[model samples]
Target: MNELLSTEEKRAVIELLYQLADDDFIISYRGSEWLGLAPHIEEDVAFSSISQDTMGHAAMYYQLLEELGEKDRDYLSHARKSNERKNAVLLELVNGEGHYLHEPRYDWAFTVVRHYYYSQAKKVKIESLKQSSYPPLAAAAVKISMELHYHLMHWTVWFTQLLNAGGEAKKRMLKAIAKVEAEFEDVLSLGPLSKEIVKAQLIEEESRLLLSFHANINAVFNDLSIPYKGEFTSLSGRGRFGEHTEDLSEALNTLGEVYHSDPGAVW
Candidate 1:
């Protein structure tokens, strides 16, 4: 059985949980938008599975929050405003300019790069969380880690193949890498509560997490003979602090359409 957490520790834990849950929820929503619009039918199915897995992870985090006396999972997910969300801006950005239902100009290279980078970061974070001082969280980390191997392999294959194919594919992949790198710090960061979370022994320090993430990605680039300087910047505002773009506003409106209609209704 898990021990009761101190007030400060509980706050830190809740913050971290929100960050994990929101990030996965937003990204999975974006992935779901690509359901029937993927480049090919076979890939469409595989990608759907990944999206489902990601959303499942988000649900797990939200459930944890519910156990801690937060609102129910569905309300926490659908009722929260964009500014209230803790997801990184990278995940909230639209797949492209056009709507997902019509003429959706989704970028395959961006999808591959973003997924590969986020997956690596998540793996590092989960590994650290396996040693979390909170027993329930550490247990949850172990369960989540079981599913990550497949997620990592799936994205890594796409990342490597596209980078190796050369021609337009390679060019687009490189461009995507640059774009993702520019805004990836937000994804890797644990935000303003990082010090508290680390102090509570909930996870490792941000510096250590970044080191592991960079090392893993660097190894992949080296194997593929691609030049990687390994710089990550958060050009967009920090989502952890409740700052977000219009993209998140639009996403929340669309995703919450049903829930907002009747929040009190049991599903």
Candidate 2:
């Protein structure tokens, strides 16, 4: 399959794979920070499972790239420089202030909002990728959609209850929503290779995906009495374009320290 693609076509596929792989990799690390610190024990377990599943999804994408003659999955995922990642700027932000193992001031509302919003966006892309011209990607999308059903449901429960809970919960959710929206545009973007990606039918174009995304989310917002603005932007630099925040670099250091310490040791 790797040998079959034209130069531009293969580049587009590699870029798309990197974007998908990096998004899951970074966000899963963010999710892992919540371990044992969730609002309750049940949620603690659930969040960990979801993060594990997401990281597995990231591994699949990375494997696909490896088959395309890129580096091994571990090197692609654990050793790639932060600027080489193609994840959305939104997914890379720290989960609040302070260290997770120390006097962590992590915000539950922000965690809930970011994961829920990101899950929705991921679902939208996965649905389109089900029909991706690339057979392996489409197959992976089908397999991923199975797990996403439960992932979305888990987050949906939190997203709805917290937003409509009233008082501080509502206020916190709203603030989190605004902060997430500021960087959500980068999530929806397909990056500089989008034209070639779309041209090769790797997945639907970004506008089409964005339109479907809005429709899917607006229904929930309406039920909760929140007005739908549909406005999103990249306040941070675009991650898909090799631009990122120090947040990503910091995250890489923490998450990859084990692999870095002994690159030959198997996880």
Candidate 3:
């Protein structure tokens, strides 16, 4: 696989890999913060499993980058600064405001909406990647897609149930959905390298993936008698362009605490 890739092709592949890895890594860290704070004991355990799977997916993408001659997976995941990261800004935002532990006011509605929207986008991207011209990426996409079914199901159930619950739950869910939609375009974008990524046949075009994502989500919304306005915006700076918020920096510090303490230590 290494021998087959030209310099330009390799660069594009590496860029896409970083975007994938960083997105998963940051979101999974956010998920981890919710570990024991989930609505119930059963959900706490379930959410942890999902978070672990997400981080595992990030590790897989990081390994692929390592194979392409990038920095070691640990360094890529831990040592990079927030501005050097490629995760979507939406993934990096704080759950609410206060710390996940202690008198926190984390938004369950936001979590449900964000997770549902993200999982849908991820499924669309993974489906397109399964047919990627890069055999290694296609293979990795196939592996990632296997776990995404459960991830999608879990979030979809929560999304619909919460919205259908009515009263404050429904209102909060709608508000959260609006917030998520405001910056969702960044999640659909392949960054500034979108042209090259698509030209190199690394993945499907952004428009195609976005269309599929909208269709998938709208179907769910329709089922629940919710309005399905296929509108998306990216008011936040693009993450693929290495633009991020302080949230990412704070998350990185927390997530990399142990690694920073002993970079040479073997787990």
Candidate 4:
């Protein structure tokens, strides 16, 4: 049987879980919105796998939250307010101009850079969570770590292929990297509760995890002969503290539209 946790411990665990869960949820939703819009059919299939994996990870975190006295997973996920969401704004941003169903001009370079940068950060966090004092979360971390190898490899391949493709591809990839760097700080922040979360051993210190991410991303850039600043920036506000852009509001509208129609209905 599981032992009872103090209120503080529970809150830390729950909040950390929310951050992780919301990050995956929003990124996967954006990925799903890509659907038939990927640059090539083979990549479409591969990218879908990453999206499904991310969503599956989000579902796992939601299940953990359900066990902690939160509302049912469906309600908690779909019924939350925009300000309540903990996802980074970069993840919430649309793939490109125009609607997903309309004449969308999606940029593969942006897609590759964003996924590559975010995946590296997530891998670092999951590694830290493997030692989480919250037993359930630590166990989930173990499972999450197992799946990240494939996710990292998939994105790494895309990142390198684009960088090495030369000509227009390289130019676009560099531009995408610049854009990702602009919004990257949101991914690294642990919010106002960072100290508490670290003290409770729910996850590692944000700085340490950030270092790991820097090394990982640096190696990728080195191999591609691309220049990388040792640090990341988030000219945009931090999402960890609930600072979000209008993109997130639009995302919530799309994700919750069906669920809100008949909120009281069993279906």
Misplaced by over 4 Å in model 2 are: 264-267
Report the lDDT tens digits of candidate 3 across residue range 1-267: 788988888889999999999999999999998878899999999899999999999999999999999999999999999888999999999888689767778988998888889999999999999999899889989999999999999998899899889999999999998999898888999998888899999999999998888789888988999988878887787888998888888888988999999999996
RMSD per prediction, one decimal? 1.1, 0.9, 1.0, 1.3
TM of each candidate vs. truth: 0.97, 0.98, 0.97, 0.96
lDDT of 1 by residue, 185-206 (tens): 8997888888898899999998
List pairs with backbone clashes in candidate 2.
none
Q: Per-residue lDDT tens digits of candidate 4, residues 1-267?
A: 134777877887788888889999999998998998888899889889889989999999999999998888888778988788787777888787887888988878898889989989988998888888888888988998888889989888888987898999999988888899899988878877888888888898988988899888888788877788965666666788788888888888888998899998887
Q: Clash number for every model?
A: 0, 0, 0, 0
> What is the C-alpha lDDT profile of model 2 across 111-175, one tens digit per residue?
99899999999999999999999999999999999999999999999999998889999999999
Residue 28 lDDT in model 3? 93
TM-score of candidate 1 against the unseen true structure? 0.97
Best candidate (score: lDDT) = 2
Residue 12 accuracy (lDDT) in model 3? 91
Pairs of colliding residues, candidate 4: none
For residue 195, give model 2's deviation from the true position in Å. 0.2
- Please identify model 3 stretches exceeding 4 Å from their true place: none
